[model samples]
Target chain A: MFPALLHDALTVGAVLFVLGLVGILTRRNLIVMFLSAELMLQGISVSLVAWSRYHGDFGGQALVVFVLTVAACEAAVALVFVLQAFSRTGRLDAAAWQSLRDAEVPRRIDRELPATDAAPPVWPQLTPAGVRPRRDETAEPEREHV
Target chain B: MIAALLPTGTTPLLAAAVASGTVSLWLLLPQAPGSDWLGHRRGALGLVLGVAALAALAWAGRRLGGLGDEAVFQIVSLVAIVGGAATVVTRSPVYSAIWFALALAGVAGVLLVLGAQFLGVATIVVYAGAILVMFLFVLMLAQPSGLAPYDRVSNEPLLAAIAGGVLLALLTTSIGRLSADPPACCTIPSRADAVATAPVGPAAADALAADPLARLGRELFGRHLLAVEAAGLLLLVALVGAIAVVSRGEVAEATRKGAS
Candidate 1:
């Protein structure tokens, strides 16, 4: 006999959705933006479940399963893109990526933006193929700093 | 005249309440550079105002039916809001991810309270367990140092908050009408009533409809078969694409490094 439990649930869902939207609109970190998108998905799922329960129907639950499926796929694709973006630019900042825009449009230049502190990402160098293992006995142990 | 102006229903009250909450939440949201506006004190004020708005609206709704239900709803709702706010406001990407997980957990709790046990458990397993872990892994891979410039500052905080607040206000006003009465189209008969009243049909159909889980399975496969298949196909394509993209990136980087 819970009065307005459904309403409360809906309100909570809406709040969560808006928060996620704010996170997406504000946060520049590519990964955090993705996480915020996931948050928005969670919000929608909550509302769907609430409505499903209110009506005592299973359709909503079934739909949630499909939503989960789509989310999993999206996460996989998004992570790959994030890694690619990170590889191209050492910084995870979304602002660093502007080359994708149309050629007709001039690139945005923020004069006040702070200079990037990190060096260009260095890919691990692989030894020449079929080369014999040569231990550098004279070489000092690399300093281990994490 | 006052009553007419006030619009005597939960809709207006809920709209006002949610508007207050959203504004308070916007105020509480941490800004970059730590100085320009809306300091920590404002956040505290926002918290108080948001809670008060919800309290006042709850009073007007007159739907606080039972103690147990009310208590559970309040706890879960609070968790959801706090976790969501934390997710958005935290400076660190890792912490944001963790908070997002917490918020999703709170959502799952709400789902469970609403009797969508299956969806709740599925959400925990899929979102909390699998997706969150993957996000954490990617986050670590991308920024092993645990600090990044992008993570520190947000873009267009004021503008985004205004847009979010406006959207929340609109949604609250519309969705609040549901409290007046459940949507007539969504009304569903109880399983017992349905089974007893249904004319003798296929025994299998009747049995499937009797069990909620079975009904869900049948509905998914029976009516939404193509959608389910499409979902599975989408997953396969995504998996292959992710693997292909990662491998190609690695190879391209290796060759570039070798040439350099």
Candidate 2:
């Protein structure tokens, strides 16, 4: 009966591991991938504890403690990196951000600046001479209000 | 009151029965309609199957002489299986985390049954206390809106079948091996007895209880003094690292403003 119980636990662990693997393979969302990674960790922990119990030993249990410590550290660092990535790129899609190529910042910045030929003329020819064009009263707000 | 129903001679039998019942209940709970794939009907079927499994395990344990190492092991294993399955099947991350904690506790129970006090305590403290809390934090941070309709994975049936088949084969082989070579002992003192006799807890109450906090004080300043100090230092380091990571951008912003 106890063997059956251990068997069932091992089975559950294996199922979780497979689910996590498939999720990592198919999911495009980074957060989902992260969640999948957690599932994998959980699966391993379950299996380790089961083995420890089967053998009547404490080593496996002690190892699980270290695994937990490492997992916490990993989650903290990964989340911070994820936040930074999201801030840098509005779109979360990995494929869309291909243009952010490494070592091409100079060319990318030059492309962003407006072309001289396409710039709007500062002084229009249709404006009356000598009398400066009346500033659009509605366009400029009352500066004194500040 | 319920304990009275279980005769002294049959205490092991009752415990075994309860353990089995809990395991099956856990297995069947996930198949409930709450999950997207296993519809209400299938979920109901799974529940029925789970109940049946629990009953079967309990009956087997009772017939084989209720008080034995094997009986205890099976009970603990049943707990771990049920908890693990619940953890995976539940959609809510918090629920899953709770299930995982239960699973860890069950594992610790197994250690205690095996007469490994230090291991059991360590498992409870580290896995249940620290790891599960971290899992909860991650789950809360990555909040998934419940509005989205549930979609079962494409190859779920195939994957499940393969995994089930493999597990069945492994179990069969292991069970065959175990049955061929039975252990020598049949009945042993329960874990509670071992704990009572152990030097750590209440047994030391008379000497240390005089100073209410003496046990902890001794641990901190005695044999484990260095380890306690190291743990404190480690926590301090982790705190500093977290602060640095969170405030990097704010510090940069402040510096830029100062320069301006």
In terms of DockQ, the best-performing candidate is 1
Candidate 1 Cα errors over 4 Å, as ranges: A1-3, A101-146, B1-6, B9-16, B37-43, B53-69, B144-146, B181-211
Q: Which candidate is the best by lDDT?
A: 1
Local accuracy of candidate 1 as per-residue lDDT tens digits, A56-106: 566777888998999999999999999998988877888888787789978
Q: Score the docking of each candidate (DockQ).
A: 0.35, 0.05
- What overall lDDT goes with each candidate model? 0.74, 0.49
lDDT of 1 by residue, B37-126 (tens): 654466677778877766755554443332245777667766777788788878678898888888877888887787766677888899
> What DockQ score does model 2 reach against the true complex?
0.05
Q: What is the lDDT of residue A79 in candidate 1?
A: 95
The window of 10 residues in a row where model 1 chain A has the poorest summed lDDT is A109-118
User: Model 2 over residues B184-228: C-alpha lDDT tens digits?
Assistant: 574233233344466675544343134423433453456555755
